[model samples]
Target: MTTHLPDAAPTNWVDRHAPSALRPWLKLGRFDRPTGIWLLMLPGWQGIALAAAMESRWPDPLLMAAFFVGAALMRAAGCAYNDIVDRDFDAKVARTAARPIPAGQISVRQAWVFVVACAMISLAILLTMGPVAIGLGVASLALVAAYPFMKRITWWPQAWLGLTFNWGALLGYAAVTGRVDWPAILLYAAGVFWTLGYDTIYAVQDLEDDALAGVKSSALRLGDAAPKAVLGFYVTAFVLALAAAWVGGLGPLFLPPAALFGVHLSRQAARLDVRDGVAALALFKSNSLAGLLLVIAMTAGMWDGPASAL
Candidate 1:
């Protein structure tokens, strides 16, 4: 009953290079679309970079590497869990119809096993961090578990995703500094709005499908006002991010990179066309670069040395 359903990205490695037996599993985990990995990792890097800037030091290489691995595992686990929950809905949506669960390549029980396996791997990685980071990791499970149901109850599931996705900002800071600070809080909030903006753009791709599926999304809620709503989300993210750097005392050098980051988001908002799914996806993916720019900005603040060091 396994069907060779279409992948979101036709040329992705899972489709092109993965062995047939493994493709279903890899696709289930979304390894075929690398954007989610980058999106998930950037916030962690931004957290590391922010903490490093605060200390006038380089980010810990091991910590950054761990975040990369952890994000990949956790994201996969999340996608599997989401798929299992949304299997019925996925069968109805063209974009998700070919997914492992919906296409009958994986049963709900098998997907649950995969989720547990991924979670265990991610937990092992989480345990390598400090007690504070470890606690944060455990706390994050609530958000992760609750996210799939958000769309069923609220019009702003993307908002819930915003809260869930960027938790690394707090966890990363705690990992580096062993505690939370105001700047870290601001950075986390900034990431929330950033997710809100980009995920809303991503939802544009499934507007009609989501409507037909009875799933609520910001895209459906905003209707023709989605473009303006995206602008508002992006603007709020930029302002909060600026405040985070300023409060962290990252120095004036943070301005240029931050400006560049804002500009990238601005361009996405400016060019967004809800009716154009291809363009919406492209704009959504561009946030990865926008996130990298913010990380660079945070890291660059250390170049002049911590203001205290100077």
Candidate 2:
């Protein structure tokens, strides 16, 4: 029996929503896939929550909203840029052949225009943040611009992704306090490792295709040891996240959620079959749940009082 790859609904939806001329560019940015947006937003929210825990205040709703909008636009822009750069490579992969650039639905020049439009929207959101947050946000553009080429040069493009994705942790704290601190750094590191583990699982689905295309990935690097590597990364992520919470003085309510996150990670590691692409894609999508669970844990930890705190 053959397993079908997960269909990208957003790509399809965007294609339907856009004009015939614009559909391809919109699809390139994956406006229809909201999971990437959520993944991007969570770390920023985590940072905001950690700051709230330290200050004994609720996380700022306005800041949260801004980060949410910023995340969506930036993620879309990133996708467009990636598709444009990887058009040839994406065409070669069965899973990505339908992408706008590879399908010749959009030109590279058109994609650049779309990227600029998205960046303008992202910039509008950034201007609302504090100077420190703004600086961090500005710095991320370099990472975003460079990411598409990392696969061609390094097997560890996921590490670069970790660096790019978790930047919100820094921005969130800076938005709240206008300064960088140890707690935010710890949370950022944890987010990086978490991304590393999940993205490695995602890469597993493309292992054979990636190998044939000469693409590098952590999944390819680990081979049979991928499961164990995932375990190690998750363990580190949990430990670092816990340490960040502790440093932020988050109460005991965090312990239960953290423990639950550990269980989830263990389940993922135990169930993973690196050689099974369909199974790998399922497992990769499951990380959205894992990430949300950890966010819940973090939120509870931040909300739970000192008396009931772990």
Instruction: Give stretches of model 2 more than 4 Å off.
Output: 1-22, 303-310
lDDT of each: 0.90, 0.84
Tens-digit per-residue lDDT, 104-218, candidate 2 = 7777898899899999999988998889999999999999999999999999999899999999999999999999999899999999999899899888878878889999999
Lowest lDDT 10-residue stretch of candidate 2:
1-10
Question: TM-scores of the models, in the given order?
Answer: 0.96, 0.92
Q: On residues 205-283, what C-alpha lDDT tens digit does candidate 1 reach at each position?
A: 8888888889999989998898899999999999999888878878667778889999999889999887888888889
> Which segments of candidate 1 are over 4 A away from where they belong?
1-7, 305-310
What is the lDDT for 46 in model 1?
Answer: 94
Best lDDT goes to which candidate?
1
All models, RMSD in angstroms? 3.4, 2.4
